[model samples]
Target: MTKPISGFSKLTKEEKIDWVTANFTQNAAQSKKILQTYWNQNDSVQQLHDEFIENTITNLYVPQGIAPNFLINETLYAIPMAIEESSVIAAASKAAKFWLKRGGFKAKILGTEKVGQVHFIFKGDAKKLESFFTYLKPVLLAESASLTKSMEKRGGGITDIVLKNKTDELANYFQLHATFETKDAMGANFINSCLEQFATTLKKEATRYDAFSRQEKDVEIVMSILSNYVPNCTVRAEVSCPVEDLKLSAELTPQQTAEKIIQAIKIAQIEPYRAVTHNKGIMNGIDAVVLATGNDFRAVEAGVHAYACRNGRYSSLTHAQIENGIFKFWIELPLALGTVGGLTNLHPLVKLNLEMLQRPSAQELMQIVAVAGLAQNFAAVSSLVTTGIQKGHMKMHLLNILNQLGANENEKATLTEYFKTNPVTHHGVEIQLSSIRK
Candidate 1:
């Protein structure tokens, strides 16, 4: 059994790897070799990756792909996606191309307000706390002025600060709810710094307030942090065309396809079991772009899912309908993204991906990411309603299956052609490969 080791982080990279592999891995030599195999060749790059987190071992790489012909708001783009999934990029590309001639995607920023809070326990009269807050708000803002200076200069800063009395929910619980406009940066660090300052100011000012009693002056701060649930920081992306032009597959008529798509979304809206998987397909596109552009996909995931459940029930993020003679599909969801901070300036591929995206601002990135999600959802629903998702998905997955089976060049080429007409399945592919090998 492995024993806990203190000061493991203080060890050299090689020593750390040796210690972990020897204790934890059954084949330490093979494990060590596998870990070393992924290390960057350049010392400088390796050093940079090492400093990104504690106890770094080796880099886990995801494939970066491009989905071209994305026409958003009359502008053309080839969005970059970083993902390990098989058919995500292909599906996104297919959707983008399908919409390209039909007046591509149109996206607009709905809002850009981010939120943070300072939670605290105030055992005081409600009226007294309210009066004390009125006096303390300006001081909280003033003390955080230096921190907001640069952000303000960029046309972004603290928008508002309000005190909420939540004693009804939990005894003496209250929050200093604040909102901000962060411009081109994600502003996590900036928001956090200001929140921490507010907490300090609240504790100090309460003690000095003339309206506060001795017991009320002892405002116990629980925590100060930024929220990932940014409902107001949202964007909407959509594509519409005449219902007659909604030809997605040969088997279904344009009208049939459009109606089926609407029915599918309606099912997702009422059914949580389907809604979770439905929204996950949408995130497949959103997360890939967010990851490619060095934005926080995990944060985006949490916020989007929370927004899905905003109506007291989980529902689909994307919606579709047929109005008059037109077919329309769209998605509106919260996506807090930044193009100017965090790993954007650090990771080489992130920088390249941003440049490939024409260096979009935070709002622009939100619209782009939203469109990616809508496009992905459309592709998935279109597949589900027509030729079936497995047909195209499994076809795209053919190469991955073949590679995993260790099919060489000639074998891969032969099986690739064979599966073109036949269904692709793990067992089916294995049988075919074995038969060919014999």
Candidate 2:
């Protein structure tokens, strides 16, 4: 509501929560929980979290943190995120360091507006029913609050609406598409809230939307849910590394390192199965931020994967290339996403993250998120080009192996060296475990 906050700061925790709720559309249940979780200390058997996860989740607070030094479009901005992951901060920072000298990324948004689908099914002629929609269009346009004031103030809001009919292998269904622009808040809550009222007028126009039940066979409004396949908007970030900047090791040539990243991206583009993992790697940064902000990570993931197959071939959500000795990156996903309005306002950490980001508009949030995705992808590809994913992953995993036996730093290093030479297995670990014990 307040210019899609890039950060939430200077307010008491309660005020911060209030500010987020007033600005965005929060589920009623989530809002209540946010309030109760702050005051209530009941630690009964009713808690769903296991002891380990509970250590982080206690008090139902997931603080939001801002990622700094995001140089996008000549603007240095702070990004808000809700997540708990080791090395993400480190990775983003390292990635930013890699790009800083080469020239910061220039990122752009396709737009800020999103789409909502209100499905209505009834026994009527497709053409005549379509005409009925045409008749109702003017009426929908005439309504006030039809356009969000917050969006319209910033030059975005409901631009158009259409009704279309599509048939599946099962049957034909009617889908009413409400195309609206929400300025800073993710518009799902706004669109759904609007549709709740609009459905009233729609039911009056069509008999099918009016009735229900097994007692009679009639057209029904089965489920009215917001679609995350936001085609109207896309965010892109591009950074060029001079061929010289790619050097991380003496053995690898800058061009070869860039080439390896390009080759990996090419594989992701061509292979659907690999693309899934490829995108998942990118989402490691994305979902962590989403969870940190109280936004729906699952919905964002679903829509991104669904959008990946827009051309009917499963492919990577991101595209990377090496041109003129510089590595370029771009990602196009239906970032129909938000920072406030749901659990973002409920959870503690998420609140902290938004406070740090201070983003007021959804478009700004998307820009930061898109940049993070690009940065994360770059880190992933860079890591792959140098040492490979397994080695880096195993490096972190080895710490756990060392800790289980209380090995000191030097001992842990020695154990890692042992694993590098030996066949890694539980049985092998046990054998080494004995040797280390002695």
Clashing pairs in 1: none
Identify the runs in model 1 with alpha carbons over 4 angstroms from their true place.
none
TM-score of each: 0.99, 0.75
Model 2: lDDT of residue 98: 70
Error at 138, model 1, angstroms: 0.8
C-alpha lDDT values of all predictions: 0.94, 0.68
Q: Give residue 189's error in model 2 in angstroms.
A: 2.2
Clash count for candidate 2 is: 34
Per-residue lDDT tens digits for candidate 1, residues 251-319, read 989989999999999999999999999999999999999999999999999999999999999999999
How would you encode candidate 2's per-residue C-alpha lDDT over 179-284 as one tens digit per residue? 7776656777778766655565666555442233222224466666667877667777778766767787577998888777778899999998888888887887
